[model samples]
Structures are given as structure tokens and as C-alpha cells.
Target: MTHRLPVRVYYEDTDMGGIVYYANYLKYIERSRSTLVGELGLDQKKMKDEDAIVFVVVRVEADYLRPARLDDELEIVTTHHAASPMRWVFDQDVMRGDELLFRAKVTAVCMTTEGKPVRLPAELRAKLT
Candidate 1:
């Protein structure tokens, strides 16, 4: 399944050149992932409070194919690419209309509050699939 979230680039998201700062794409995809989980009915706060599990980004591989400027309305698309016992890999993309501006493979791991890696709960994995 793919989850899409809309984002409007603001002045703060731009660099001195008036193009979106590279780092802001990371923030955009991160927010999209959060919304994706919520739409999947995975309440992260409740998971942390009740089950002691929280998700953390472990790695990211991104490619910037095109630049987005201030006021550009973009769409962030997120989908599960793969999953292991301890991590889920997501393929996320930033698009403006039919143009692909950026893409990334983000790996996130579930961990205990103490910060040890943990297997994703079976129920949550099922929900993701």
C-alpha cells in the first residue's frame, strides 16, 4: 500500500537560492511516514506507552533528481518495500505533479525505550503488510 501526504514548501524550507533546502526533504518524508503509520492505525505514542516499543530511523539512502522551489506544492508518497524481524524498509518519493523530485529508501527499526532493537510486533507487521 502507498500513503500520500501533501506538503507546501514555505519560505523557511528554502535555501538562500530560493530552492528547498535538501534537508527539508528528509523532514517531509519523515512526516509522511508518521501520517502513514497513523493511517494504518498504529498509534506510536500508545505503542510506546503500552508496549514500550518505538520506531527509529536507522538508515536512509536518497537521491535528489530535481529541485523544488518555495511555494511548490509537493506530494510525499510512502510505501513499504521490505521488512525484517527488526526493521522495515520504506520506499518514499517526493513528486510535483508528474515529476519525481526525490526518492529514498528509509530503514526504520523498532526499539525498546532502553534503545535495544526489538522485533516489530506481529500485529503491527500484519497491519503494515
Candidate 2:
């Protein structure tokens, strides 16, 4: 399944050239990933507090294909699958209408609050796959 989130660029998101700053694309996709987790019935805070498990980004590979300007309406599209017992991989895109502006592959792993790697909870693993 793919999750979609709508975002609007503001003055703060732009650079001196009036286009989005390159790093902001990562923020956009991160929000979409958070939203996806919520929509999937997973409560991150609960997981961390009750189960002592938290998710952390292990890697990100991104490509910028186009620029987004202030006031532009953009959509973030995200899809995910399990990479292993401890890791989940997400493929994401930043789009303006039908135009693809950016794409990324993000890898995340489940970890204990003390920073030790841990296997994903069975419930989350099932949801991700």
C-alpha cells in the first residue's frame, strides 16, 4: 500500500533562489513516514514508552529531479516493505501534480531506547510487510 500526504511550501522552506532547500525534501518524506506509521495503527510514543522500542533511520538515498518553489502544493507518496526482522525499507517520492520532483529510499531499524538493535515487534512486522 502507498500512503500519500499533501504539503505546501512556504517562505521558510525556500532558499535564496526561492526554490526549496535540498534538505527540506528529507523533512517532507519524514513527515509522510510518521503519518504512515500512525495510519497503520502503530503509536510510536507508546512503543517507546511501553515496549522500550523506537525506530531509527539507518540510511537514506535520495535523488532530486526538480525544484519546488514557495506556495507550491506538493504531495509525498510513500510505500514500504520489510527488509529484515529488524529493518523496514521505504520508497518515497515528492510530487507536484503529476511531476516527480524527488525520490528517496529510506531504511529504518527497530532499536531499544538504550540504542541496541532489536527485532521489530511482530505486530509492526506484519503491518509493514
Candidate 3:
């Protein structure tokens, strides 16, 4: 399944050239992932508090395909791609209408507050798959 969320480019998200900053694409995907997980019934805050587990991004591979300008209406689409016992990988994309602006493969690992890796909860994995 794919989860999508709309984002409008603000002045702050643009560079001096008025194009969306390179780094902001990461932020957009982050928000999209959060919403996707939440929609799957995984409450991050609750997981941290109750399960003592937190998800941390360990890797990201992205490509900038096209440029998005200020006030552009963009959509972020996120989908679960793969997972192991302790890590998950998601594929995400940012688009403006039919044009693909950016895409990324994000990998996150479950860890304890103390920083030790932990196994991902079965429920969360099931939901993602």
C-alpha cells in the first residue's frame, strides 16, 4: 500500500534561487513517513514511551530529478518496501503533478534510548508488509 500526503512549498523551504532547497526534500519525506506509520496504527511517541523503542534513520539514498519552486503543490508518497527483524526500508517519492521531483530509499533501525539495537515489534512489521 502507498500512503500520500500533500505539502506546499513555503518561502522557508526555498533557496535563494527560489527553488526548494535540497535538504528540504528529506524533511518532506520524513513527515510523509511519520504520517504513513501513524496511519498504519503505529504511534511513534507511544512506542517510545511504552515499548522503549525508537526508530532512527540509518541510511538514505536519494535522487533529485526535477526542481520544485516556491508555492508549488507537492505530494509525498511513501510505501513499505522491505524489513528485517531490526530494520525497515521504505521507498518514498516527491512529485509535482505528473512530474517526479525526488525519490529516496530510507532505512531505519529500531533502537533503545540507550542506543542499542532492538528487534522491531511484530505488529509494526506486519502492518508495514
Candidate 4:
């Protein structure tokens, strides 16, 4: 199943053309990822300070199809492409109603506080099921 997050485009998220600023799409995607982790009872700050591990984006590939305007109510769809002990790959799409504005294949690696890749924690990995 895909995780869906509701996003409302604000004026600050827009460009001079009044459409969403290009870079803000990345913000939307990251927010959904953070929410997904939170929903699974994983807190990045607590995990990092306590367990000494965190998740970091290792790769990002995106496609921009259409423009999302200010005040548009959109849905960010995130689906797990691969959820493993070492890393998680998510296929995410940003949409306004039935219209797709952008899509991305984002890869995040489980890492140590010092920035080396690490294995995913057992309980956290189970949530991908």
C-alpha cells in the first residue's frame, strides 16, 4: 500500500509565476518520508541520539510533468520500491487531484551518526512489511 500525505501549496512555496517553486517539490517529498518514519514510531532525533543511526538520502531522481499552482491541494504518494536491512527505495509522486505534477525515485541509506552506511534496525525494518 502507498502512503498518501496531503499537501497544500502556499504562496511561499510558489515562484514568481505563481506556481510551486521547483526546489520546494523536494521539501514535499522529504516531508512525506519523515512522516512515514514517524508513523512507524521512529523519531529521527531520538534514534540518532539513542541508537546512533539515521536515514539519509543517498540518491534522488525526479521527473517534473506539470505545474502545481498556489493554494492547490495536492497529494504526495509514496510507495516502497525496496525495503531492505541496508536501505529503502521509495517511488514518490506529487499530484493535484488526478493530475500528476512530479514523480521521483528516492533512495535513502541507513547511516551512522558519523555518516557511514549502516544496517536498518529490526523494528524499523518491520514497518516496511
Candidate 5:
């Protein structure tokens, strides 16, 4: 399944040249992943507070294909799949209408707040698959 999130390129998202800062694309994709988790009925806060479990990004591979300027309306498209019991992978794209601006593959691992890796909760794993 795929998830879509709409985002607007605001003044704060841009650099001195008025184009989105490269780092901001990572932020945009992070928001898309967070939203996807919420839509899947996962409560990150609850997981953190009660189970002491949290998801942390372990790696990100990105490519910049085009630039996005301030005031541009963009959509983040994300598709997720499980990589292992403790790892989840997401492929994301940043688009302005039909134009692909950026793409990334992000890997996240389930971990304890103290930083030890852990298998994803059974319920959450079921939801992702």
C-alpha cells in the first residue's frame, strides 16, 4: 500500500536561493512516515511510554532530481514494507504535481528507548505486512 501526504514549500523550508534546502526533503519524508504510522493505527507515544519502544531511522539513501521553490505545493508519496523482524523499509518520493523532485529509501529499526534493537510488536508487524 502507498501513503500520500500534502506539503507546501514555505519560506522557512527554503534556503538563501529560495529553493528547498536539501535537508528539508528528509524532514518531509519523515513526516510522511509518521503520518503513515498514525493512519495504520499505531500510537507512537503510547508505544514509547508504555512499552519503551520507538522506531529510529538507521539509514537513508536519497537522490535529488529537481528543485522545489517556495510556495510550491508538493506531495510526498511513501510505500512501506518489512525488511526483517526489527527493520522496516520505506521508499518515498517528493513530487510537485507529476514532477519527481526527490526520492529516498529509508530504513528504520524498532528499538528500546535505551537504544537496544527489538523486534517490532506483533500487532505492528501485522499492520505493516
Candidate 6:
């Protein structure tokens, strides 16, 4: 399944050339990840209070395709690619209408507040159903 969220390129998200900044693509991916977790009924506060765990991006590999200009309405698409006992992997893409602006593969690991890797909590694992 695919998850999508809409985003508008704002002035603050651009570089001097009025094109969306390279690093801002990662921000959009992050937002989509947040939405994905929220839709799964998992959030930071609940994770902290119940499982004492949090998911953090351990790695990301991205490719810049076309450029997006300020004021362009974009959609961020994310797919849950794989999951293991302790980690999740996703394929994400940023698109301006039908044009691909950027794409990435992100690996996130479940970890405790102290940064120790942990098994995916039962609640999160259950939600994958």
C-alpha cells in the first residue's frame, strides 16, 4: 500500500534560485513518516509513556530527479517496504504533480530514549497488520 501527503513548496523551503532546497526533501519525507505513524495510532507521547521507545532514521539514500519551484504543490509518497523485529524500511518519493522531484530509501530502527536498539514493540508490530 502507498501513503501520500500533500505539501506546498514555501519560500523558506527554497534556495536562492527559488527552487526547493535539496535537504528540504528529507523534511517532507519526515513529515510523511510522521503521518504514517499517526495513522497507525502510534505517536511520540504514547511511545514514550508506554514502550519507552522511539523510531529514528538510521540511514537514507536519496536521488534528486527534477527540480521543484516555490509555490509548487507536491505530493510525498511512501511505501512500507519491509519490517523486521527491530527495524522498518520505506521507499519514499517527492513529486510535483506527475514529475518526480526526488526519491529515497529510508531505514529506521526502533530505539530507546537512550539510543539503545530495541525490538519493535508489540503495539507497533500489531499495527502492521
Better of 3 and 5 by lDDT: 5
TM-score against native, each model: 0.94, 0.96, 0.94, 0.95, 0.97, 0.93
lDDT of each: 0.92, 0.95, 0.90, 0.90, 0.95, 0.89
Per-model RMSD to reference: 1.1, 0.9, 1.1, 1.1, 0.7, 1.3
Better of 1 and 4 by lDDT: 1
The true-versus-predicted C-alpha distance at residue 102 of model 5, in Å, is 0.3
Q: Model 5, range 54-129, lDDT digits (tens) per residue?
A: 9999999999999999999999999998889989999999999999999999999999999999998898789877
Angstrom error of the Cα, residue 39, model 4: value is: 0.4
Q: Which has the greatest TM-score?
A: 5
Better of 5 and 6 by lDDT: 5
Question: Model 5, which residues run further than 4 Å from truth?
Answer: none
lDDT value for model 6: 0.89
Candidate 6 per-residue lDDT, tens place, 1-129, comes to: 589999999999999999999899999999999999898777778888787888889999999999999999999999984478888888999988888889999999888988899987677777664
Alpha carbon deviation, residue 124, candidate 1 (Å) = 1.5
Winner on TM-score (5 vs 6) = 5
Clashes of 2: 0
The RMSD (Cα, Å) of candidate 6 is: 1.3
For 62-109, candidate 2 gives per-residue lDDT tens digits of: 999999999999999998999889889999999999999999999999
Off by over 4 Å in 3: none
> CA shift at 95, candidate 4, in angstroms?
0.7
lDDT of 3 by residue, 61-122 (tens): 99999999999999998877547888888899999998999999999999998899998878
- Give the alpha carbon lDDT tens digit for every residue of 1-129 in model 4: 589999999999999999999999999999998998888788889989998988889899999999999999999999984466788899999999999999999999888889888887778677676
